[model samples]
Target chain A: MRAIVLASRPVGTPSRENFEMVEVDGEKEKLRAGQVRLRPRWFSVDPYMRGRMNDVPSYIPPFRVGEPITSEAIAEVIESTTEGLSTGDLVRAHLAWQEESVLDARFATKISSDPGMSPTYYLGAMGMPGLTAYVGLFTVGHLREGDVVFISGAAGAVGSIAGQIAKTQGNFVIGSAGSDTKIDELKQLGFDAVFNYKKSAPKDALRSLAPNGIDLYFDNVGGDHLEAAIGSLRNFGRVSLCGAISQYNSTGPTPGPRNFEGNVIRKRLEVRGFIVSDHQDERVAFERDMAGWISSGKVKVLETIYEGFSSLPDAFLGLFSGSNNGKMLVAL
Target chain B: MRAIVLASRPVGTPSRENFEMVEVDGEKEKLRAGQVRLRPRWFSVDPYMRGRMNDVPSYIPPFRVGEPITSEAIAEVIESTTEGLSTGDLVRAHLAWQEESVLDARFATKISSDPGMSPTYYLGAMGMPGLTAYVGLFTVGHLREGDVVFISGAAGAVGSIAGQIAKTQGNFVIGSAGSDTKIDELKQLGFDAVFNYKKSAPKDALRSLAPNGIDLYFDNVGGDHLEAAIGSLRNFGRVSLCGAISQYNSTGPTPGPRNFEGNVIRKRLEVRGFIVSDHQDERVAFERDMAGWISSGKVKVLETIYEGFSSLPDAFLGLFSGSNNGKMLVAL
Candidate 1:
């Protein structure tokens, strides 16, 4: 079996040299009493993976060098020794980037067996990313009806779902994306307004789009976008800091929003940073609401997938360059 | 009667030239129905007043140039035309920097009749500043017992009270101040650790003082202090952004904390910016708890008062220079 490993930590922006594909003996270890053998059907490559590559203290430990990089993945249970005793069952769990791997049965969650649904949705809209969007919007951002909501990285995995969810609640939703195609897709997804951040600065775009001021900001791309959101937010505005893809690969510390004192203090704003995993308490509600939204055509699921496992590094690298429109995934 | 007016708007830092003393007829306006004639006895000079000097949108409106600047004050009601029956009563209200003024009685809260309590305490420890510290620590920061708490501008009005309140909860309280005197004062106030930020960088001081990292930061001085607090905060840390005295006088936009993305997001921190006025709903509880704390000697009240009403502008400008050890006030 083949797996991708972190060859070395990158100095600044990561390159292909930082990752290496390695051959692993799939059948070397026997399945223990509480373990199951898995063949990953789909592997998720996200911007957060970049943080794991660095030797820094964070919520999750850094990815070990010379080991398979672990992330959320959907796999098939080839064999099982647990009480559940399931073979050919589709499960979702935090797994290594490999074609074949063994996992503790307790760590894996049995995916929805509905034949009408795509198993890939478990890695995007109905999975971690979906829960991230849901929690970031309702729990963190405090999204309310009639709120002028702004989302950065609008066409990306979490942002797309967050924007659509806000729209469902009759919010005035504005989104900023890197490409014209993403902006168009966001508009099609029922965003009140969309702008290509690559051409128009987020600050200026927000001024015209949300002429009054935004009530809530779903921040994904940090740096300039975060600054712009802070500047354009109305009094008592909220900011849900979900991710900062813009500063993830920076070599040195990046300067934060200059108007933090003038705006955040004067406006009495609430800027909260959160990780989706910490909000797992909302999983039941998230899964129910998200599934309903998707089934009712309220949320349009999108993904940018790679053909094979060997393209995992490329798929991960593309996130930095805005190569993927939504969730970036690799199929086995 | 005499009043100080805004002579001109400040460019960078305010100076004596920006204020003017003018003579006014004390009896020109009659105390109408529902109004009271006030003789201001003490005036408050706060850092937030600097924001009002500029014509920017904020929770409070900007002070009109060439008009008397208004602030929290303790006034004696010499004449009352309202139904409240307030003759010889000391009341707290937002009043002008004038010897005599007529204001609606509804805006004023009658001060406690307790003979042992000083009238000046209403302008400091028993008033807005006291409520600010209480709300920032308990309501916003969600301070827990045994948590390590860091406070910037710890010798100032809000920070001093905040540190003491946290101390009462058996929390390890660390404080950073601008001068050796302030540092010594903070130590006297029962801070577990105190450092002169002028002599040592906040980041280095915090690293040595709080080796395990802090759980909550009461930020009265933003900019570098904020950056240091964010860097030193542990996972799930909370910051109560009360004021940014360091950046209040800057001509240009001051660069914010550089590690915002890395620290705030990775640590899942909550940074809440607030003004004391917004939390008036907590006044009843604040008055009860704070008065009890002060009476029991668990909280000590401190004030730096300038003599005479003529010192209003100087007292206000002194805030930017760290001229006052605690709450800066001008006594008439």
Candidate 2:
């Protein structure tokens, strides 16, 4: 089995030299009770995986150098000796970036294939990214019918869904993307207004787009965009802090929005930082609502899938470069 | 009657030159329906007042040049044509910085003198600052019995009460003050641990004092203190951001805690910014509970009073210099 390993932690931006694929022996002499052997079908490459490369304290453990990095992936049950398991059962687990995995079945969740839909849905829209958007908008941002919400990184995995959900729930959504193409895509995704931050400053864009002031700000890229949101938020505003991907690969610390605290006190803003992993209580509701939206064509899924296993490294790096329009995934 | 007015806006830190004392005619042309004449005796000098000195859009309008800069004050009703108000009635209103005011009586709140405490208590401990501490601790910070709490600007009006309330509520409390004198004062106020930030770095001080992570951080000073709190906060910690006096008077923007977002995300921290004015529903409950605590000697009120009306500007400027500990107030 071939697995992607972190060759070395990058100082600034990660390059091809930072990651290497090596062959590993998947066959084991013995299998313990409740153990399963699986062959990964679709390998997921996500932005959060970049954090694991660095040896630092985070929500999850750092990815060991020379050891295979893993993420959420849906795999086929090549062999199973555990209860409620079958040979052809498809499951999702933190076992991606590798061609095969042999581990306890308790850690894996079986993916019930939606009729006439793709299994990659388990890796992107119907999975963690989808749940992240759901929890951020509802539980974190406190989505209201007439809320003027500005979502940064609007074309990314979480922002795309968050904007769509906010829109369908009767919110006036404004979004910021890195490219003109992504801006157009965000408009098609039902955002009321979309701006390309690379073309113009987000602060200026938001001032013009959200005339009345933003009531809820979904922050995915947190530097200047956060500053703009803070400036444009009305009294009693809420900021759902999801990620700051723009600073994820920096060699050193990046300062937060300078005007954040002053505006926070004046406007009485509630800025909450959260991880979707800590909010599994909303999974059932998220999946039900998201499935309904997808079925009704209210929420459309967009994926930039890399065709082969070798494209995983580029796919992961492309996230920082804004090369992918939506959810960046790697196909094996 | 003499009143203090903004002669000019200060560039960074305010000085006596920025303020002017002017005489006003106390005699009214006529007593309109619901009109009242007031003579203020005790007026507040809070950190929040500094934000008003600048010509910027904030929770309250900025102090205009040549206009009387006012805040919460306890006044004696000199004359009232309005019903339900007597000449000897003690009242609190948005009418400080002035020796006397003639305004509609509807905006004023009557202050009932407690059995033993002074009327100045209505301007500090049982008023806005007191309510700010109460709400910030329980409603905003979600104070738990065993929560390890850290409060910045521990010598100030709000922070002093916050530390004592948290300590008396059975939480381990650590505090940061600007002076050794303030640290000694905090010890008398019942804080478990107190450090002088001027003597050492707050981050290092907090690290030594709170070996166990901080569960709730009541941030009164924003820059370095906020950074230290973010670093020391445990998983799912809450930050009740009441003030950021460190950066309030800055002419230009100051960068926030360098690693704030990363720590907020990694630890799933909840940082909520609030103004006590938005929380009037808690006033009745706060007064009832605070009165009990004060009677039992569990909560102590501290004040650094400046005598005479001429000392108002000096008292206000002294807040920025850390010269006055406890709640800075003016007794006219």
Candidate 3:
């Protein structure tokens, strides 16, 4: 069995040298009565995974040094000792970034590979990134039809999916990307408007596009984007703070909006901060709607595929620099 | 009829010199069938009135220089041509700062004074200040029992009443006042703990008082108090931004909490800003509860009385300097 483990905590941005791809031979651990053994097929390299690598108090615990990092991944079951699961079944499991994983059968669920869909789709559209978008927009954001929504970091993994979900809800969706290519891609996905925030100031660009102002702001990249969104919000607006990728690496103070007090008072706004784990009860509801949307071609999944599990650090670091367009994934 | 008019806008804090007291004598000329002429008995000098004096955007229109300032007041009908209102009837009306006003009969709600209660009670606990605290705490803050509550400007009108309400609901209430006397007054009013924020740093004071953390923060002074509250919030904390008195005189950038992003994310906090007018539908509920609380002695009211109506400018300006003990009012 082989796994990529963290060598040490990085000071600023994580690098490839911080991880080591190690191989070890051991006795074949037998599966317990209700256990399953999986051969990893695909792994998710999400921005949230970066948080897990650092020693910070977040929604979840950080990964320890000299330990295998685990995330939602697509795998194939080689042996199973449960009533529902059987050997040779393709499944999704809470597995590590390793070639093989032994876990309880209940933690693994069968993955459907329909005629046109690839196995990689399970690790993305039907996976964590998709669920993150669903809960953040509908549950936390309380999104309604015809609402004007602005998605920050719209070219990234969760933002891309969140924008599409808002559009599907009959919302006027605007997205901000880092590059012209990503901006064009968002427009192709039926975003009412798209802007390259790297080229134009977010406040000015959003002001020009959304002359009427934003009703709901789904923030992925925080800091200036949060401030801009606050400035551009209409009266009685809703702000859903999902992530703050822009401020994650900074060591200095991130000056929040100067007129936050005035805006909040005059607009009578609601700014709620949330994480996906808070909405565990809605997971089943999310999966049901997401699966139907995928089947109906009403939803689309984009992947920035990075080859080999050893390159996980690069895929994770790429999130901050806008190196990936969609859910950055690593093929095992 | 005489009125106190805004002669000119003040440079920083307003003073009595900024108001011009003029007198005029006239008959009630062709008053409408459902109209009455009333003499103001008591007038409210609210902090929000300061915002109206400036030409800045607020929930309501700003007051124009050289115009008569208007506020909610209790008055006596001196002349009546209306079916409902009669001469010598005491009523509450939304009118101007003049000694006499001609208004529609429908705008005046007749009052029957209880032998035990004072007419001034209506202006403090049974009126706008009462409803402001009610709607802000329950509707916006989602206040719950056993929750630790921290209120800024705790000796002021709404803050004093709000602290008692939280205490009655079985919550441990902590309050911040300007002077040690006001802090002692808050403790005497049943605030579990109180601090003199003018002498003690809010963050350090709150930390020592509520080491476990605050569940609900009612923010009236927004600059450092809001910053301190944000830092001391517990997980799933709720912040209700009612007013920002600290920033009223601020001409420069408002310095606040530096790590706002981290505080919001780590706590899963909900920060909402509201004006009582937006929740007009809940007035019936507010009035009912407040009446019951006052009648049952479950809640108490306090007011700072300024003797003459001519002293209104000083009363309004006194709010910024923390000169009033409770709701500041001018009696005619």
Candidate 4:
């Protein structure tokens, strides 16, 4: 089986040399009790994976050098010794970046076959990214009806879904993306206002778009975007800190929003940092609401897909460059 | 009557040149309906008042160039035309920096005479500063019993009271101050750990003091102290953004904490900025508990009082230099 391993830690921006493809003996391992052998069908590559590449202590442990980089992936059960598992059953779990994985059955959730949904949806809109958007918007952001919500990295997976969900609550959603195409797509996704952040400063854009100031900020790209959001947020506004993609690739610590103290105090703002994994309690509601929205065509699923196992590194690196729209996925 | 008025706005730091002592005709204007003629007995010089001096839009309006600076003060109603207020009644209200103030009676709260307690206590321990500490702790920080609480500007009016209140809740409290005398005083006030921030870096101090990290940060001083608190906070930590005295005098926008993005997200920290006036609903509980705590000597009241109205500007300026031990007040 072919597997991608972490060759070395990257200094700043990651390159191809950081990862290497290696051949692993998959069938050589004996099937133990409560274990299942999985053949990966789809793989997920997210911005958060960059954090794991570093040798640091975090909520999730770092990816070990010379080992398969593990992430959430969809797989098919080829052989199972567990009572709940059977051959050819589809499952989802945090698995290694390998063609075949042998792991405890309990860690893998059996996916019920749905003809209306694509299996790859489990790696994108109907999966962790989707759950992240739902939890960040309603639970962490405390999004209310008629709120003026501004989302950074609006073309990305979580931001796209979050914007749509907030729109469903009758919010005036504003979005900022890196490209003109992304801006157009955000507008189509029911964003009341869309701006190319690469061209226009978020502060200037927000001034014209939301002159009355925003009620909530769904922050993905921190740094200046975070600063601008803080500046434009009205009194009692909320900020849901989901990711800081802009600072993720920086070699050193990024200077935070300069207006943070004065604006937050004067506006009585609430800034909450959250991770989706910390909110598994919201999964049932997320799955139910997301499925309904998807079926009803209220929430459109978008993905930037790459084919073959070799394209995994390219797919992951593209996230930093805004090369992908919505969820970036690799099909094996 | 004499009043201190703002002659001009200060560019960076305020000076005596910015103020002027002027004669005002107090008895020239007749008392109107529902009005009270107050003789201010005690005046407050708070850090928040510095913000009002600047010509910027904030939670409170800026002080007009030629107008007397208004703040929470204790006064005696020498004359009243209102039904609720009587002659010689002690009242607390936002009054001007003048010996005599004619204002709406409804704006003032009548204080019942307590021979054991000083009327000036209303300007510090039992007033806005005390209520601020209460709301910032329980209502905003959602403080739990046994939680590790870190307070910056720990020797200041709000910080001292907040530290004492948290101590009563059976929490391990850490305090950072600018002087050894203040540090020693905090230790006497039941703070588990106290550090002179001027002698040692807050980051290094917190590492040795709270090796396990703090659960709640009562931030009265922003800048390096805020950064240190963010770095030293445990997972799901909470920060009550009460003041930023460190950056209040900065001429330009001060660069915020460099470690803000990484630490806040990784720790899932909740940083909420609040003003006490917004939490007026908590006043009843605050008065009840604060009165009990003070009467029992569980909460000791500390004040750095300046004699006569002439010392008002000097007392206000002294706050920037950390000259005051606790609440800085001016007795007229």
**Backbone collisions counted per model:** 0, 0, 1, 0
Highest lDDT: give the candidate number: 4
**Superposed model 2: Cα runs more than 4 Å off:** A26-30, B26-30, B33-35
Report the CAPRI category for model 3: medium
What TM-score do all the candidates reach, one by one? 0.97, 0.96, 0.96, 0.98
Which rank order by DockQ, best down to worst?
Answer: 4, 1, 2, 3
lDDT of 3 by residue, B73-155 (tens): 88999888887778988898888888889888998988767765677777788888878888778889999978999999999
Provide interface RMSD per model, one decimal: 1.0, 1.2, 1.6, 0.9
**Model 4 chain A, TM-score vs. native:** 0.98
lDDT of 2 at B190: 84
In model 3, which runs have C-alpha deviations exceeding 4 angstroms? B10-12, B15-18, B24-28
Write down the C-alpha DockQ for each prediction.
0.80, 0.76, 0.63, 0.83
lDDT per residue (tens digit) for residues A1-332 in model 2:
78889899988789999999998886763668888888887877788888988898678899889998788888888888898778899998888477778879998899887874578887778999999999999998888889999999989988998999998899999999998899889988889999999888988898789878999999888888888888899988999988988888887778778877888878888988889998998999888898888888899898898888788899989999998877888777
- Put down candidate 4 lDDT per residue, A133-188, tens digits, no spaces: 88888898999888999999999989999899888889999999999999999988
Best by DockQ: 4
Q: Is the docking of candidate 1 incorrect, acceptable, medium or high quality?
A: medium
**Model 3 over residues A259-326: C-alpha lDDT tens digits?**
67767877988888887777778878887888788777777777898888777778877887899988
The residue-by-residue lDDT of candidate 1 on B14-129, one tens digit each, is: 99999999987655787779999898889998888888889876677899998999999999998999878578898998998888878988999898876557888888888888
Task: Please give me the DockQ of candidate 1 compared with the native complex.
Answer: 0.80
Clashing pairs in 3: B52-B63
lDDT of 1 at A179: 92
